[model samples]
Target: KKTVTFFLVVLLAVSLFTQNDMVSAEIKPKERSVGKKCLEITCTMTYTTQQCSTHCIQMGYATGDCLPKEAAKPQPPEYCCCYFEK
Candidate 1:
């Protein structure tokens, strides 16, 4: 009985660690893809989508938009977020 319990404990620990690694591995690719495609630029509320796209094009990105700041307070200043192909 003691040996069975020990084996189960080890198996549980290994499974937990592997599950965490798999979760992180799944998340990392999304983070890397977004990091590669997006650039955040400070901008005012008056910044337009066309202007943002034009600026991004000039800077070599495929497109852009004036979007709200991530994880910011409600009604935060907009950012010119540019997207590009990898």
Candidate 2:
């Protein structure tokens, strides 16, 4: 009986220790749609993504052209980064 109790206790301890590696603690970035494309555009300006969104809307679906792969990153870079689909 004592041997069985020891084995059960050992098994429980091993399972608990093994589970810690599977747990995670990281945040994921959010992706938002710009117009009708699958690619995205990012703008930097002022603060908050909301501000950048205004700029994105101006060139909206009417010109949902995907930027060249070699195009530079958006301006204002500090914040207000918006994404559009390609």
Candidate 3:
């Protein structure tokens, strides 16, 4: 009985954690555009900043970095992992 109870508790904990993770993962922040299209180029990230060489010519530039889009990066809104193509 003790073993069964312990197992049940562990199962419950795992299920709860998994549910929380799923909920957090599903939640996403909004995306803003910078208004430009950019050339396809590999960008470098320095301690100070990470930037791409492309012209960023898309009509709608992302509010933040145009690299990691929501679909691509999977992070919250502060940074823009997505970009609008020309």
Top-scoring candidate (lDDT) = 1
Q: Write down the TM-score of every candidate.
A: 0.44, 0.31, 0.37
Candidate lDDT (C-alpha), each? 0.73, 0.48, 0.47
TM-score of 2: 0.31
For model 2, how does the per-residue alpha-carbon lDDT over 38-77 read when each residue is reduced to its tens digit? 2344433333345445554674533332233333763332
Model 1: colliding residue pairs: none
Worst 10 residues of 1 by lDDT: 30-39
lDDT per residue, candidate 3, 2-27, as tens digits? 99999999999999999999989789
Candidates 2 and 3, the one with greater lDDT = 2
Write one digit per residue (lDDT tens) for candidate 1, span 1-86. Answer: 99999999999999999999999998775433433233466665565778888998898877887766664563556677787655
Q: Model 3: number of clashes?
A: 18
> Can you rank all candidates by TM-score, best first?
1, 3, 2
Sort the predicted structures by lDDT, highest score first: 1, 2, 3
Name the weakest run of 10 consecutive residues (lDDT summed) in model 3: 47-56
Candidate closer to the true structure by TM-score (higher is better), 1 or 3: 1
For this target, which candidate reaches the highest TM-score against the unseen true structure?
Answer: 1
Over 4 Å off, model 1: 1-41, 71-74
